[model samples]
Every structure is written in C-alpha cells, then in structure tokens.
Target: MVSVHRAGALLNEASCFLCRRRTHHHLRFPTPGFALPREASPSRRSSLAAPFGRICTRAQAMGTESYTFGPYKIHPGEVFYSTDLSYAMVNLRPLLPGHVLVCPKREVKRFVDLTVDETSDLWVTARNVGAQLERYHRASSLTFAIQDGPQAGQTVPHVHIHILPRKPGDFEKNDKIYDAIDEKEQELKETLDLDKDRKDRSSEEMACEADEYRVLFS
Candidate 1:
C-alpha cells in the first residue's frame, strides 16, 4: 500500500495527458486500505457503511475533472454506461454513427495498471456495444484499439478503449484517417458552440459539421 505523502507527490507531477502539459493532475493517492479498527467494528458501529466512509471521503477530496473524447462525455455519474459499471459513457462522436468508448470507472493512468477483472470487463463491454452497433447500424466490423501512452496516441492518462464501428465506405484512400478525423473535429469545435454552457447542439448542426468534414475529405 502506498502512503498518503507518497500519493500526494505522485499526483502533483502528473502530465496533462493529451497535450503533454503539466496542467492536468490525473493521478491521486488511493486511501489506505486496512482491516477496520477495533472501535469501528460492528459491535460498536452504528452502521456498516461507516467503516468505508473515510476511504470514500479521502478519494473525493483528491478532486477530479471530466473530459470528452469524440461524442462521449465522461465524469462521475450513475447509469453512465450500459454496462453495470458505475462510470463510463456511450459515444456521441461516432465515426460510423455507432462507435463507442469502453473505459474504467477508476482513474488508472496506464493500461498496465488495470486489474485483470477490469480489463476483462472492459472487453466485455466493448463486445456488448459492438453488438448494439451491428444491430443498429449494420456495421461490417468493429475495431477495438487500446493505446497505452504517449507513443501510442493516448491523450488522457485514464485508460480508454475506443470501439469504432467499421463500415464499407468509412475509408477508401489513405491510412491517415485519425488525423483527418481530428482535423474535422477541430473545425466543428471552432464553428459550433460545444462549450460546457451549450453542451447539446442539435443533430442538424452536427450534420452540418459532418458536411464541412465531407467537403474537406472529398
């Protein structure tokens, strides 16, 4: 178990993730886990939840922020994913109208840090979303790309597996598809009001953004 002091040091020096800036503080020291103290035993405790309260409080005090990747907006929320996990979200920025993201509920910086169960659950969730995409959009295939760090193009420290639905005409000419998509996303960001205050823009507006991208690619 890591000590509180050590945890603090680790969190502070963390990188900005996407831009390599120092501004993003993605790591936090987990609360020390130990057997319950004698005084917190059920015999004296008023509630079973009390013993776990300190750990929860410490984690919350660590502070966190939300991020958007494509159409999915991730934060602390219940029912965020169709999976039973408490956090995660469906993709709003779909490559083929049904792409999704399968991510962990915790703030793990690297894919190697994921517990065996966490990794398994992530794949299961991706498969589930893939099924949905196939049923809804008639996708020919799905691509699950999991990049671990900077060299692999991981923008956020938190590990996320992008489940992209593949279609027949999604790509035809080149392999630099991601660069093209990122450029179009930026163009939409500039022209549309996707700020926190104006989060949800109409589908018509999104379609217009798509038209702008189609022109660029064409």
Candidate 2:
C-alpha cells in the first residue's frame, strides 16, 4: 500500500512517461529507476540485429527499464517494450517463434485486482505488441491468451497475456499450444522455485531476442 506522499512523488516522475506515452501515472513502483525506456538512436539499436551467438558474454542492456513477473525478477535486457503501466518480455520457453508476455508492472496476481487503468493499458500493450510481432515474424495470424487465475492454469501468479505470432498451418491445432504451455509450466514449476532464475532460454537468448524487438519500437 502506497502512502499519499509517495503517490504524489510518483505522479511527478510520471510526467516523464506521459510525455512520450500516455501511460497511467499510478503504476506500482517495484524498483528504483524502473520506468518507460528512453529513446535510443538507431545506431545504438542497430547492434541488436546481430545474433546472440556472436556475443560471447551476456551484458545488461543499455536501457534502464526493468520489471518483474510474479516472483521472477525480469532483467533489463529481456524487456523490449514498456508503457508506464505494463511491459513486454520474451518467453523463456516459447511455443512459437515470436511468443512473448505482456504483464502489468504492479505484480497483481489476479485480473480482478487490476485497476481499470491497468486493465486498459495491459490490452493496449498486447494489441500494439501483437501487431509488431506478426509483422516481424511474418505470420498470418496471432494467438492472444490469458490464463487469468490458478484454476485457469495461471503460472507464476502474475496476470499476463501471451502473444504468439502464428504462421499458417504451423500450429494448426489450438489445444496443442495450450497443452504445451501447461506442460511446460508444469516442468518449470518442478524445477524453478520462482526466485529470479525463471529461465529456459538462457538470459542471453531472451536478451538478444528482446534487443531485436526493441528495434521495432525505436
């Protein structure tokens, strides 16, 4: 629970986010210096196009934006896009080429807990990111899904929308992907304690992919 004084200070910093993107001002502050990404020059972003394999070591991204998904701390490099309220991060174990997750910054476990503003920003972020992914992946369609809660197979407890860019006939059956998602989550649950190390694709892999996607927004 945030006090009035803290909330007021947040509103002051929110002007930075609102100037570039009309994002909500009341986003929960999980960490210091976590905010909407500042604009990067094309030359700075161009390096993102290179394959991750080319780089020998994993380095934190030049961008300052960072976020979390449930108990998992999302690294800065893995975050591609963000509004004041929400951010998009690559899936560690994707069912498709361009599968990603758009999550609210608040770490709200259930959808019902979301403020109206958070709800609106979450979907808007999804819609915007889905379009970019579809174009980038050159897919014929997309899959937008939300598990919503534990009964609905929500892993990690945080509410998130999964966006998968689909090509024709590649993933013909709908149930298959959802099944895969469930199965994968089950495997992760057994192994990961949900404390920072929520990785399947190495951090470098997710970071490189995010860097590529960052180019779209920049």
Scored by TM-score, the top model is 2
- Model 2, 74-102: lDDT tens digits are 78877888899999987665555677889
Q: Model 1 lDDT vs. the true structure? A: 0.43
Lowest summed lDDT across 10 adjacent residues in model 2 is found at: 22-31
Q: Which ranges of candidate 2 are over 4 A from the true structure?
A: 1-62, 188-199
In model 2, residue pairs whose N, Cα or C atoms come closer than 3 Å (at least 3 residues apart or on different chains), thus clashing, are: none
Estimated TM-score for each candidate: 0.48, 0.68
Number of clashing pairs per prediction, in order: 2, 0
Give the winner by lDDT: 2
After superposition on all C-alphas, the RMSD of every candidate to the true structure, in Å, is: 21.8, 14.5
